[model samples]
Structure formats: C-alpha cells, structure tokens
Target: MTTETPTPLVDFTAAAAEARAIADAAGVVITAVDEVTAARRVNQLAERVWGPGVGTAVDLVTALAHAGGVALLAAQGTAGEPATDVGFALGFLGWSDGLHLHSHQVGVAPEHRSRGVGLALKLAQRAVCLEHGVRLMRWTFDPLLAPNAHFNLARLGASGTAFLPDFYGQMADSINAGDRSDRLEISWRLDRALPSKRPAAPQANESLVLEADSRGWPHPTGEPLGPGCAVEIPGNYSELRQLADPRAPAWRQAVGETLAGAFAAGLTVAEFRNSRYLLAAPHRP
Candidate 1:
C-alpha cells in the first residue's frame, strides 16, 4: 500500500484565546455589540472616527447584529475602571459561492489610536469568521493612506489586487471630503498565519514614476520607466488636506494615473517600502 501523509492539525481554540488575551493586555475589551446601549456607543464611535453624518444608526446596527454579522466594539479599561467605547467595527457575511466575509468599516477613536484597538478588533473579527466557517475576508481602503496600506498589507496579511476609482463618489465625512474615493480592494485569508511582513521584492533600480514635490504635491518625476517603478505618496495626506493645498487634485490625478497605467501593463504591487509602492512587472513564462 502507498504511504499516506497525515494532515496537519491547527489549534484554533488556543489561537482565539490568545487573541482575547492580547486585547485584554492592551486595556481594551473586544465584545459583540448586541445591547441597545452598546449599539448607540458604536454609532457615536463612528462619528468620532469619521466625523458628523457618518455614523450608522442604532437600529441598523442592531438589525445587522441580529442577522449574524460581525458587529464589535472596543472598550477601554475593562472591569470596574469606568470603561468607555474607543473603537468599533461593522461587517457582514458575503454571499459569494465561497465562504467569505466583507468588513465594511473599522475605526478607532482619535484619542485611543496607536493603542492596539484596531488590531484587537481585527483579531476578534478573525475569531468570529472562523466560527462562521468563513475563510476569506475582503475590505477596501484608500490607496493613498500610507498607514492604512501598511496595516492591511503588512500587519494584517491582506493583499490588494484591484483599484477602484471614485468608488463612493464624494463622501460627506470630514476625512474623505474634497477627495475621490479611490480604493484598493484587499483580501485576507483567515485560515493562514498572520504574515510578519511583506516579502522583499527582487533588487532593481526601480524608476520613480510618481513622487511628491518639495511642497508635498505629487508630480511625475523624470525617471525612465524600466522593468519596475516606485510610486511615492505623502507620509500623511490628512495634513495635506488640512493645508488646503491647491495641488491636491493634481496629486490625486497623477498618482491615480500612474497606478492605473502600471496595473494595466500587468505590473503588480510587490511591497510598500519607505512610503513607496514597489511595483513589479509580470514575469514572462
């Protein structure tokens, strides 16, 4: 008889527990937002993260939660310490043929950012997905946002494959106002290990196709395109917005065109380094 290989076993139970412990250590408790009061807190949290007119209604949140979606909130300073809601996430099940989840929104309170609240919420989302037999999670984020790019692609092990231009038209929120809702659609495989970091791409003298000028406006740097290119973005676009820079629109168009052109030519984004997107051309067979 031919020898058979045994399947490797995974300890998801321990994994879930470990995720919970991480949130606890961060002084935040991640839990399902089922109660009416808790749902209201999430609504308020949405406002805090995105500004006025962006928060979901309590009724809608409750409806989605009752329909078995992943609606969770992060609260600071757990038991007997006068806790408060600092972050929240709203997501729903995907109806695709394969098991999938679509994370619609995840936001952390401004004061509570950089405190592991967002990471905690994501880990909790993974646990909920596993319970529902979902193996794939999809989400969309603005491609110009550097921190978000790093978080989704590097920290959370998500990969982006598609670029959507003006996906939501003009958003009313303060954060997205005066900007096109260009998004990079990303996918995360819940069954796999969290990648420590994006693997380094092959060494090359990549051309800088899109780069910021001295005033932080994006311009086409006079670099000859080769097998690869680099697209650099401002380290903080929020500050650019605050400055009301007249070149903001130009920057948007320039970056959008460069990315679209590269992607259309069958180039893929390989890694994010030094706030630059390292793009690689398709390999010949």
Candidate 2:
C-alpha cells in the first residue's frame, strides 16, 4: 500500500482508541502494549520459541519505515489485555520487512479471535498497500492449519511459492503442539483489485481431491523444497486426508464424495504442505 512512514513510535493512543472502538462495538476491548511489554513479548518470541515476541513487532515497524513504514497492530482489553485482539499489518510491496522478509503483520487477538476481525484488519492493510503502490504483499504461516488454510486460500486468494521447515527450528510453545514446524511462504498478490468471481461451478459428475500427502508422486520423497519456493493448498490436510480415505465413512459425510471425488479427478498432486497436499503441474525436468 501507500507505505506512509508511520510515526517512528506508533501512536498507541490512536491505535488503542481504534481498538477500543471495535471492542466496544462488539462488547470487547483491544489494548495496545507499550514498547517494554512489546519488547518483552518480542524477547519471549526470540528466547522461547513458540509465539512471536515484541521484538518481531519492533522489527516490523522499523522495516515498514525503511520500506517506507509498517503499521503495528494490537488488540486487547482496556488496560491489561484486549477482550478482542487484532493486528493491522502493512509493508512495502517490494520492501522486505526483515523476519524472513515480508511487509505486513496483521492478526487477531488470540482469545478474541474469530468473528471476522482478521479479515477486517487485512482489508484495512490492503487499503494502505493500494495507497503506497505496493503490488504484492507477502507473509508466512504454518501450512497445517485448516482454518487459516481456507482463510488464505479460499478467502483471500493468495498464492504460495515457498516452504521453510522448522522455520524457527522448534518453538517451546504449545501451539506447535504435536506437529513439526513447517511454514508456507505465501504472497497476497494485490497488484490489482480482486476479481468479482464466483466459486467454480461444481462438476457433479467428477470426484474432488480434497487433500494430498508427501508420499504421492509429486512429493517425490525428499524432493527439493524451501521457504521461497512452494504453492498453496487446502488446510487441515492431515485430518482431511484421513477423512478422504475410503475406509472412513465420516469423510464422505462431511465434504461429501462428489466434491472430493471431483478434485481427485481433475488435478495432479504436488508436494506435502505439512500433511496437506498442494496441487501443481507436473514438474519440468
């Protein structure tokens, strides 16, 4: 977006105010953390290995300014923590905002998540991108999340080209939970306004391939893969794969056989994105 140089120090007051407004409307609160607190969180993210720390945010803001400026977002309670938390991310289209090089950092409050706040923050970020002539904004996230998968792929229409494993190696957080830390490097191609297109017409006669795994041909067992080169695919792929398995009756009960069957019929499978399968053209030699 128009990467306006946000004040060196983000106006926590104004950001807090906007957060409060949104929270109040929803009967929740979004609070901003000071540099100290932000810094600590950043430190924790750095020292510890589960969630991102305040340092990460600091870096984002710094790079934003360097790339022309980044907007730091926070959502929490009135004073302590936000009843609803949100982050607004902005970065130069071409400028890399450090932390693996990206230009946005919008997100929602952990406790106050859902309810469409992430989308709102993203929409707002897009406005900034447009204002600044940013054509492609990028970010990274774990590939196994079903919710985020649908959000990024089905919702925002982003495309992927990279895959980084143990991107941070290992985090001491519970969210990494049981899975290995593999991340998808994706780009939100905002070069142009989004298209007013509808979902693809269902091919009733065709079976859909809901998810792919690492074992299949395209994956090629230890084939070349990395952060800057991968593609997008569905989320909750592991769970979905189990469901899609013919032996599982519940799989058909959920997505239904038609959609899943059609997908399988139409596409060639690609690499494994943390248990989920990404479809792509057969690789060129």
Candidate 3:
C-alpha cells in the first residue's frame, strides 16, 4: 500500500474576502448586474469611457447577465447619497479545452482611474469565476500600451499566449480610432495565487528585440534571443496617438511584428517590467 497526497482545495471564500477588502480600500462598491436598469447603467458607463456609439447595447448586457454570464458594476457613494457608477466588467462563459470565462471588456471612468478600482473589479471577477468552477479566464488587450501590459501580465499574473495583429480591425472609439487593433491574447488561471508584487525590472544585459528611438518611437533592434530578452515600448502611447504622431503607426507595426515573431519562435512573455516585456522560453518536462 502507498500513501498519496491529497490535492489542495480551491479557497474561493478567501478569494472573495480579499476582493471585498480591495474594493473597500479603493472606496468602491462592486455588485453583480442582473436587472435591466443595472445593465443600462453599465452601458452608460461604457459610453462615458470609450465614447458614444462605442458601448455595447443595453439589451445585450441584459441578455448576457440573464444567460449566466458575469456582469459587474463598481460604484462610490456616502451613507445616504446615491451611488455613482464608476466602472464595469463584462464576461461570458466559454469552452475550448475546458470551461472558462471570456472577459469581453472592463472600463473605468476617466476621473476614477488610478484608484485601484480596475484591479478590484478584476479580482471580483476572478472570485466569481472560481466560485462557478471556472479556473481559467481569457482576454485580449492592446499590446503596445505599457500600462495595460503591466496591469494584465504583472499585476494579474496572466500569460500572453498569442500576438494578433489587427485583431478587431478599425475602430471608431476615441482611444483607438486611427490605429490598428493589435492585441495580445492572455490567459489567467484563477486558481493560482495572485502576484504579491511586480516583477523585477529587466537587467541591463538583456537583449532588446524592440527599442524606443530618441524621438520616443519604437524600432525593432533584432530577433528575439530565446530567454532573457526584452521588448521596450512607449510609456505614453496614448500621448503619441493624441498628437497624431506618424511614429505611432510605426510603433504599432514594429511591436506587432516583433511579438508575433517572438511567439512564432516559441518564446513567451514572462513578465512586464521597466516599461518592457521580458521574454522566456517555455519549460520542457
């Protein structure tokens, strides 16, 4: 007879508790949206973030919520005052190899950014997924934005699995109106422990596949050199876009080609640090 170790149980209650603590510290209240009124509020908040005619319709949000999807709203208010909506996250159930949640969008009011409300909403979403036996979540985001790359890869401990150029084609939103919609598809394992701190910055000796020029534009330096390589991007891509800088499209093309090639060569984005994406080769067992 042989003794075997039992697998540890997923502590979903603890996850929910921590999410609640984060929301409390951020001074925001997160609630599930199940009714038409709440769904409409979510749509309104989306419009405020992305611009008019860019948000999902109220009927779709309502339908998704009623069909066992995850739709959450974040608000802030005092004891007697009515709560003002500040953020929303929407996702639907998906299945590939196994059940998972495909997070479609997460938006925060411009005035409410940098307050940890976004992170709180994500954690709350994670808790909801784990409770429903969904251990995996997937989403896509602009790969050239340093802050978004750091938020998803470093803050959430998610892994970028693919580089998709022009993933959504042209868009009319204020944020991405004139640019290609290149995206990094990432997967988050909800059962895994969240990162306690950001990853260490890339070392000075690391080879850079992409580097910024003196004019603050991206340029491809060389092919990825397996593990311990880095890809530097603009720290203020939004500013470049706002100025209609010609270099903005150059940055987009350079980053898309570099990441797409790197992924093709079997390298993965291990971490994002120092406004760079650090690459590593997958482990073989």
Local distance difference test, per candidate? 0.79, 0.44, 0.88
> If the candidates were sorted by their lDDT against the true structure, best first, what order would they fall in?
3, 1, 2
Give one digit per residue, the lDDT tens place, for model 2 in 1-285. 688442232233433344445445554322223344443343333323225432244554444445445453444456665333344344444545422226434544455467755665554455454445554567767655657765665566665455555566755554553444566667665533333246544333322234334432122223233222233234444564444543232322322232232234443233333434345533332
Ranking by TM-score: 3, 1, 2
What TM-score, to 2 decimals, does candidate 1 have?
0.85
Which residue segments of model 2 deviate by more than 4 Å? 1-68, 74-85, 88-104, 195-278, 281-285
Task: TM-score each candidate.
Answer: 0.85, 0.50, 0.93
Winner on TM-score (2 vs 3): 3
Q: Write the per-residue lDDT of candidate 1 for residues 1-285, one digit (tens) a residue.
A: 999453233245744876798698778888898878888898999999889878988898998888888999888774577788889999998766456788999999999888778888988888888876777788889888899888887777676656788989999897998799988777777766666554655446777888888877788987755446788877777667788876666767887887777777767675676787777664332
RMSD in angstroms, candidate 1? 5.0
Clashes of each: 0, 42, 0
Candidate 2 residue 23 Cα shift, in angstroms, is: 11
Query: Between which residue pairs do clashes occur in model 1?
Result: none
Q: Measured by TM-score, how close is model 3 to the native structure?
A: 0.93
* Candidate of highest lDDT: 3
In model 3, pairs of residues that clash are none
Instruction: Supply candidate 2's per-residue lDDT for 255.
Output: 26
Q: Ten residues in a row with the worst lDDT in model 2?
A: 216-225
